[model samples]
Target chain A: MTTIQLPPLPRVAPALTCDPAAISACGADLLAASAQVDDLGTFVAGRARVDDWTGEAATAYHQAIAPTGRRADAMSLALRGVAHRVEEHSAEMQRLLDRRTALEDRQQHLAQQVAHLRAEVATTTEEGAAELQADCDRVAGQVQAYETDLDTWVSDLATEESEMSQAFTRVLGADDVDRIYGGVADPADGPLRDKPGAGASPAEVHAWWAALTAAQRRAVIAAAPGAIGNLDGIPASARHAANTVALGRDLADYAHTEDAGVLTDDERTCYDNALAADEARREIEGRHDPVTGEPIVAQIYIYDPAAFDGDGAVAISAGDLDTADNVAVVVPGFGTDGESAPYQADRAATLYESTRVLDPSATNASLFWIGYDAPDNAPWDEGYDGAGVVTESMAAAGGERLADTIDGLRASREDDPAHLTAIGHSYGSTTTGHGAHDHGLGVDDVVFVGSPGVGGDTDHASDTGVDPDHVWAGSNSRDPIADLGNHGWVHGETVFGAGLGDDPAEDDFGAHRFQAESTTRGGAYSFGDHSKYFDHDTESLANISHIVNGDYDAVQEAEHLHDPFLGPVEDPEYDREPTSPTTSSLTP
Target chain B: MEVVPVSVGEASRAWDEQHLDLDAAATQIADADTSGFTTHVRGAATRFLAQWQRHAEGLGTVSEQRADGLRTTIADYVTSDEATRGDLVALLTYTQEVR
Candidate 1:
């Protein structure tokens, strides 16, 4: 009982002329045309079929055509009639051939048009892809050009900013600063924001960051965070950061050589001498210790040529710069010995010189480069030169020699015993720590730069083994050696000591350490490489000067702090303060 | 913790009594007669010890509180003496057979 159903035909597009009246009219015409074409086709086909079917009749008609006279007359008529029928059939076959040819031509023409259209579409698609590729390349070129331009612009802006900072700092010192800026110079002048620079005194610069536009202030804040507190007009945090940036920018600019506001002649002389003394070049003599009977060496360089020159003048506060009130000692690292190059001596001398140059005054400040051991190529030289030899035996010997050296200096300058600073770089720092540990040496500050180990910490006073309340460190990210060497060795108790609460080093390690800001992290000095603390023009020199002079604020302001290692200390006891300070005392 | 302490007077007396005899022994050190060496050494030691003793005298009221500083100075002098003696011994030993 299953019913069969026919599939419906696919719907066709609405008839081209679908209006009822037009459709009816066109239908009659279409039917008539179709009928005519069909009738012509049928007639041609039927004639061809009949001709093929009746070959005998065709022969008979051909025969009769030639037959009789009265029969000839009749034959003539019959022949004529037969000829006419043959002519009619021939004409119909011609018509059918013509129609078939037209239909074939139309189909060929349509296929050709379709092929041409496809070729055009392919060409257009290829062109579009090529255009897109060209656009991408152009964009990349523009990006690279922009990057280069930005770099150049930033470099130029840095230079300009430094100059502006110096100029503004000078303006801050003027007696009638308000009057000068009230309506004078350029259009940048106006009422001070929140009465800034209005009550400024002429004695010394009091952190008076000059008036800056909002954008300029934002740039400063971006450079050094938390520098300037918010002024009346600006947010407190943003302003504070900007001010800090301005201070660095200003001081850094003020110290620049090409800048307009650099130190004057007399001022330059003071700074030069101090820098020279700080980097004083001299021969360090190692001899048998009178006490330990061991070979001991003492650094015999003068911190100041003034100590040698009687006519030298000393000032306390030159211009906006202030001399350090305290003193510091900087011990040179490994490879520092009498045989070290003359540049070594220059580097040591330059440290004192740069500090004096920055401060240009004498407020009980001095620095020393302790070249206690002969220079060796490696920190691990086997026979009396390496760390192993030093730790096992030379340390005690150096300690004795150091004690004697300290005693000699004390005797020579008994008048000023209170303000002394000691700085140590690399292995020299270890030597300084030994001196402090074994002799109970008295110093205002002990600073270590590029130190491998000093066996002490500033934060854990008990574990420090040295008693100096202020211990500073300067390890710049630029110094590769700071991260090199045996990191796993328990550096005494603390993995690393507490920094002087300032950032001079740019790495995270710098945050936990102290740094010298006035000088750039990696200055263009020739001696900016490993163990080049005494190198001339390097920030290490400035750092040494600051430490010995007890410029705590300056060191803190450098903004070079960071902390790379954050894991909790493994052995806290090593960093814990000792129960009694005197217990670990090496004296009696 | 209960280590016996040496008084400055006692230490000084012990050094004084043994001073001459020690000088004799210094001459006979390392199986050699260093008589000439002993005289110079004794002279230097005398001057150094005398200065040290003078300094020690200035440190008054010896007790645990004050003794540490004085003791450190004394120990330092003793260490110095020992070191100097060690140096002299090494040099003297080298020169003994030649003499």
Candidate 2:
């Protein structure tokens, strides 16, 4: 909303020359020339007064000397000579005036030059400030990454220490004697012997199981019914004890007498079925190609129930399209797949829900929930670095897929223009940028949420290959992952402008279309981490809904910059929510 | 002039080595699909040969001597980062196709 106003130019010396130094020098010369003119004028005026008095005295003397013509001639000749002397002084004054005029002109030129230099210096200084700010932003992004890594490491270490402490406690408890102990008296036996005067009596236990060897463990587990089944509630330590006992019993029974033979029809059937099921599941999962083998997770979701109006039941394949009134393709970031927990699904589902919430009357809308080729972890996936490289490639592929989908959709609905919006999160934002670059993925609006950085400059239209008029962004303060991504991960030198100017945390998302705050810090319904950008009812999701529904006024009214790097500030009403969120039926 | 023998991977390493002529070497190797040379690739040819050899062995094509021949020729002339060995395979395919 801020406008810049340039200062007015000041006139000093002559304006002929553009040099500031020359103008300054001209001004100085003019000042001295003017002073000389003033002094000379005063001197000439004084001399004129004295000459008038002398003439009067001479005329009086001639009249008193002789009434004859001889005295008159002498007086007239002397007066003529004085008149000539006055003429000479007049010529000298004219010459001074000419010199002063030339000096004034030079001074004006010098003045103009000085003004120009001042403006240039100011502009250079402003440019330098911008560069410094960019450097600061880059460093901040690095710091954010470092901080996240440190946090993860510390958390890991803490978990390990806690587990170890629990193990030590169990050992100590075993020596109390009140707790049952067997099997070579356990490792703590020696310590117990040193302090035997203390605890309660050991609980009675069958000696046969405690003496089981390591080989017995596997045999016992294999023979046991449902040994690994439905043991979710059993603590790991308890499970280990039960397994150990089972193994010991099995080994003694097998070694002592296995003469009965291996005839159990039910066991064979069960084993075969289990193996077949495992193989089937593996086939369904689809292994990666060995040559270009990279870990990736893929999924497909169908939204439409049936072929309405005799339209094809099949959705268009990649780079093909069937027309629809509204189509949205949501690209998720790293660590996302079909097996993702309810929390992740909820985040992804929010996009569809938010879109519907924005436009209740959009009945023909279809949303493609894409999780194709998403990695299990980041920076480990081959060809994926940041928004600039792998994400960009993903976007390129995704965009092609989207284009195909749109074309197929268009084929079904002849009247629809096939409006598409790409809503990407974190690394997905980079993919969105690459999609824009490919020019095949026609998008009306591009929104990035909880993004570290997109692989393009914030000048989205020109620099990022998207229409600068249709970019949106958001970030949250308590979401440390988003903050880290925004600060340290240079997605593509993207600048955003959605943060609160007062809070340093807000600036991390960069200057962009929109950055919304979570309802609470680290809220489950808000962007919680690197992956959950579209939590249920957060401001970030609201902004995305508004933009996708063609409610630019609503977004602008909210003071979110669509293209922060553009000219002119226009105000329009952007309702906090979409047009009519409840009209569409999403119950199925 | 004959182009220097350097893959992009090698050029990258050479740059790290602080070699003064690395830039020139990079230029030379950038488009060197010249006669009699193994196809210019982005990564090391030697690694590609090893990976393929392992694959071949697993597939029961036990011509160990032929594999060894390919590997030696590669190790002698190719110097590059092992991480991007696939690039070498791609180049070799191009080389065979041209031949």
Candidate 3:
């Protein structure tokens, strides 16, 4: 009369009541409302000082409407906060609901198995009953495990709901709104009281930033956006937010001052820089992600409009820097500044697209880092002064900054490092060389394109703090600037050259030189060819893309340049012939 | 005292336009749907929307009031100018008769 005990099957109901689409729609509406309110505030502020409406009444009107504008800003910020939370919650709810559905289906299957075993056990003979009992025990154990999993899932759902409520409470609190978005602190005092200084290491900065409360971070961004926007080790998304706020505020302030005809000379330069940055951001933002079909995310990694004495340092990324499998920093050469951001961003976008085309599954990000004060004039310019281009001072300084930036990237993503590469063009290659040689640029690969020289003292590719095999160079046959580097002469006579450094494309430079012939024009030498390395459908761009995608075997190699007694020689195996003019002194 | 009627009228019209924009923004925020959210989130969203609506409406009310104030001020200024002109004309007429 001994009974075979079985575990009871539990109920398998999953309540998934949230509609993701509706929640997303609500978030969109909230964002629209926020924008509208912002526009209203801007209108009120602009209209406060009407033409020919001066004197006591105008002053009173300005004073009276100022508070309304402040209120509008606060309200808009509050709406944005709630919208962000709601949107995030919607995504989380969808994931949880999916998991719950899977669990419920498993529960149903297990319940059916239990019912079948119970029915068999009731009709089986003694010998058959033992086998049926074994089946029952296995089914009961599975049911018990599923019940445990179900309990854990239920607990997780409850925890998520509770966290969501807390988040909403924090977002909707009135004090938080006024304190965070009210712009209560002075800009000169910096954003947060305890924020790391410029001299702090990236790791220190990252730690300091991670320790702040969410509200505190928002307050800091609102109070001193320029400071936070350019700080290294801050997450790209946060930097983007801070930089965007800074850009808008600066533009508005500059526009107001310009309208009043009181803009200073320095302010005018910064204004142009701001406009350029905005144009660059707009260009990237207008592009659609190939995979997601959504507007591409552009991060303003660096936004210092007044840096480099108004040459203006700026870096804009074509993808998410925080979470990408591969990352490349494209450093432009001479004549680059904030004004060059649009073109640089285009180049970065092209490189990004090329990487995506090469490998569709892998995530990639490309940054147009015009972080240094590049020489305003090229060495090949008609009346080129030897002040900036002929010397390696600018490159060395820029290299230091580049090293810091790369190090910051490493520190920020220490948990999951990316396949980082530095692609330098023209004098940027020199800067990159200096960075790797002098400062140990912590990148997996170094690519020098149309390089005049890597650095003044870097004679070998191995001197660039990377394996000589990993160092790559691409010099268009007709690129005059690429020929500015010194090549070893024949007859056992070492030539003391006046170029920036040893030519990376030379056979003795110990760097892999790739085919970079400019097919756009058939000239013996064209300055335009130097700029064509990054052009689409070009062998040079393809090779660079292969290197960026970490597919080194796919790269097409080219013959290296060698200096002979008669003239500069090239291997006949390569189809393109060297077209650079022969010169005794390679200054340019 | 030296207000230009054209400028005052333009300012008043601008305020009127802004008032409409603010009102529309307030309505948009207040009418945002929270029906798809779970009970706890929906409740929070409703409260937040209601509070933000008040703020927006408050700004809208200020805009409307400013527009009204500007309109009244311009009208009063024009009326005062007209009265002053009439007094000057009457004075000139009375002086001419005396002469």
TM-score of each candidate? 0.31, 0.31, 0.61
Q: Per-residue lDDT for B8-99 in model 3, tens only?
A: 56666667656665665667677778887888677877887787777667776787787788766665565565536544443332211110
Expressed as tens digits, the lDDT of each residue in A254-359 for candidate 2 is 2222222431443333333223222322332243322223211112222111111111011111111233345556666555433332333334334445555566
TM-score of structure candidate 1: 0.31
What candidate 2 gets wrong by more than 4 Å, as runs, is A1-324, A341-348, A364-366, A378-414, A456-459, A484-512, A522-532, A556-588, B1-99
Candidate 1's DockQ is 0.00
Model 1 CA RMSD to the hidden true structure, in angstroms: 52.1
> For all the predictions, what are the DockQ values?
0.00, 0.01, 0.23
Which parts of model 3 have CA positions greater than 4 angstroms off?
A1-191, A378-386, A489-498, A569-574, A577-588, B1-99
Error of 3 at A242 (Å): 1.6
Model 3 interface CAPRI class? acceptable
Please tell me which predicted candidate would have the highest DockQ against the true structure.
Answer: 3
Q: How does candidate 3 score on lDDT?
A: 0.75
Give the per-residue lDDT of model 3 (tens digit) for A294-316: 66678999998999888898999
lDDT of 2 at A536: 49
